[model samples]
Target: MGWLAAGADHEVRLDAGRVVARNRQGRVLRSVPKAVRETEAYLELRQLHEWLVRHETACREQVEQWLVRSLPVPTALIVEVWADEAWRAPLRDLVVMPVDDAGRWDTDRAGLLRDADVDKGLGVVDLDGETGRLTSTQIVLPHPVRLPDLTDLREFATDLGVKQGTRQLFREVWTRPDDADARRRELTRYAAAHYRELRHLQARATAAGYRVQGGTATVKIWEDGVPVVASVWIGEGDPAWETETGPLGFTDPAGGPVRPDDVGPVAWSEGMRMAAALHAGRVIAEDEESA
Candidate 1:
């Protein structure tokens, strides 16, 4: 914003989301003068900064929602929002795959998002650090569990010093064991986590962006055109009372149990991720003795 006369001696303008002042001699001050801070220009800039902060947060949450659901976003939609800093910030450097007309993931062609141009398509940097563009009509930011060569990808990301605005490559994932009794083992794996209070467990789930209803912390995943819900029961009794978390389980849209062996990889990993997050905190109640 252009500098505006603040007082007889000072002129102020919005600079890099901050209201900065310059003396009459045209030297930038280290900080806004005490008197200038109360000026209308400074107040306006502060309000703008607050709005931008909210905008950035909202954009990031939307992008995270897309990643969790593994949605195939339209390329045009990406291009439309690519210009906005709030939207671009969360999208930049996220590993993306082009989706063919038949909706199959071009797994062999994954790249870190870098730019979007209407005529040139989405520009990206691939695993080999080669700059390229994918002209596919749609693309997906796959969940880590769905990604191939994840170990190598993490190494490559680290080598490049890449830091994603949203968790993707670095997101923790769980691989459901494949065995004769995998179902039972998976069910018991993260179960019976003792919490000092039922409310504490519930609070953790909610704070981690999962929905808690009917004593369960829940997240839904859409895999292979089917919806699966994963939930961990925290308990329904008195909120203040101590409790133990129940087994993490998955169910179909119709509410039928989905055995761990039958659960899709993305769903299994995300479910376990949510379960682990809620199970992480444990405290011994004063009434109980340590093992």
Candidate 2:
């Protein structure tokens, strides 16, 4: 039988071989008859919940990649994705800019997209601190390019009480430790004593969007218009099934060592983050024993 109304504010369904009753908030009111738990409705609900979890994870990962790479996205694509309930939740209320047909972005056209309408197009709150609908045919998801007038834009956004749906691009970044010795010590503190297999470490680094080369994991970032590369040495394993990691290194585009004080904040933090992640993945002797 289908779900039956047991009370004005409760519902009963056979779920996982049990007859369960729940309130509007999905709180369990009661459960009985273990046989009802295998009902189709119960199984369907469980499957839907699992699918939603995966969908949400996918959405967040995709969006984060765009933010990290500062890649440009098309407005129509955003509108298309917004139609899906699963995608809409993560994308709704994000700051967007309408690109002109000539491939130019005017910060004046930038606004928080409140809603997507089939007939009227996008509802946006513009930079002038005005709320209106924009029917532009095309727009671009701008790269997090540093702008000269960003301070004024931030103040305007603050006045309008705008909260970005995603991480802000070109946000003010912090500086890291200036002392090379101190920075080196901090970076290597998490080095694993036991070697992690080279293949395993490579897989982890690749999955994390880092370049794995010659037994090292490298992350590249731009600092002060200069390219800096941070590398962690995940060495080739020995015949006895052991591998080792060396100290973290930072270098400039010209392959010269960069002092910690010279590294930009974003590069420093990202480089350290990569090192920590690799360290965490190290296969310690204790972990092997526990396994």
Say which candidate scores most in TM-score: 1
lDDT of 1 by residue, 1-291 (tens): 688888788998877867789999999999888998887767877798789889988999889878877878999999999999899989999999999888899988899999999999999999899999999999999888878889989998999999999999999988877784875777767777898788889889999989999888899888866899999988988998988888889999788998777888888889989888876776655664553
Candidate 2 off by > 4 Å: 1-20, 23-27, 30-34, 143-149, 153-161, 169-291
Q: In lDDT terms, which candidate is top?
A: 1
lDDT of each: 0.87, 0.65
Query: Candidate 2 on 137-158: residue-level lDDT in tens?
Result: 7654433433335566677767
Q: Where's the lowest-lDDT run of ten residues in candidate 2?
A: 139-148
What TM-score goes with each of the models?
0.82, 0.54
Model 1 scores worst on lDDT over the 10 consecutive residues at: 282-291
- Regions of candidate 1 where Cα sits further than 4 Å from its true position: 1-50, 284-291
> How does model 2 fare in lDDT?
0.65
lDDT of 2 at 121: 74
Clashes by residue pair, model 1 = none
